[model samples]
Target: MGRPLIHRSPMPGLGLSMGITLTMLSLVVLLPIGALLLKGANYGLAGMWDTVNRPRVWAALYLSFRLSLFAALFN
Candidate 1:
């Protein structure tokens, strides 16, 4: 019987891999979040409730819920 081939990665290459992962995360994830951070940081509970319970927002939320319910049943 033949044994399956196992690939071995070098130990020192681990540091390089870690550096690449951290750099990718910091640049790709952290660079473009100023708006999201500001929005979330500025949101108050009363303002959130007011926005959600408004007439237009409530209509859209109701429609989304019904559509998602039907889609889930079939999908």
Candidate 2:
């Protein structure tokens, strides 16, 4: 048997609200991630690996991580 209907919400415009929420979420979250993925694809796996493996990249990453850790500890 089908489930009994529950009480309906008194609120209106749920469809419009959901559309706006999805649009905002896609623009704010998905677009940048998609761009990053496209960039990585263009760079290719070996190129990305080489870039990350560079000494300067490693140093900068290490410094950033250390600074973030220090800030977190301070806070």
Candidate 3:
């Protein structure tokens, strides 16, 4: 016979730890990405492109890039 699918773990509270880890992973990493994907889907590609193409967005991007480069060079 093959090994059982579920076996007892040597470490106590392993299931609880796993549950907490998965919950934190879902909340911290997955939810915001899912929301962004949903919003992007609602907007469609052209709308997303138009939003990104604005002068303000470009200016902010350029400023952030220059600041990041400056900090990186010093660091």
> Which structure among the candidates has the greatest lDDT?
3
State model 1's lDDT.
0.81
RMSD of 2: 5.6
Best-to-worst TM-score order = 2, 3, 1
Candidate 2, residues 1-75, lDDT tens digits: the string is 999999887888888999999999999999999998889888899988988899999999999999999999999
Every model's TM-score? 0.44, 0.54, 0.54
The superposed Cα distance between candidate 3 and the true structure at residue 70, in angstroms, equals 0.5
Candidate 1 vs. true structure, TM-score: 0.44
Considering only N, C-alpha and C atoms within 3 Å, which residue pairs clash in candidate 2?
none
- lDDT (CA) per prediction: 0.81, 0.93, 0.95
TM-score of 3: 0.54
Candidate 3: C-alpha lDDT: 0.95
Question: Positional deviation of 70 in candidate 1, in angstroms?
Answer: 1.0
The 10-residue segment of model 1 with minimum total lDDT is 32-41
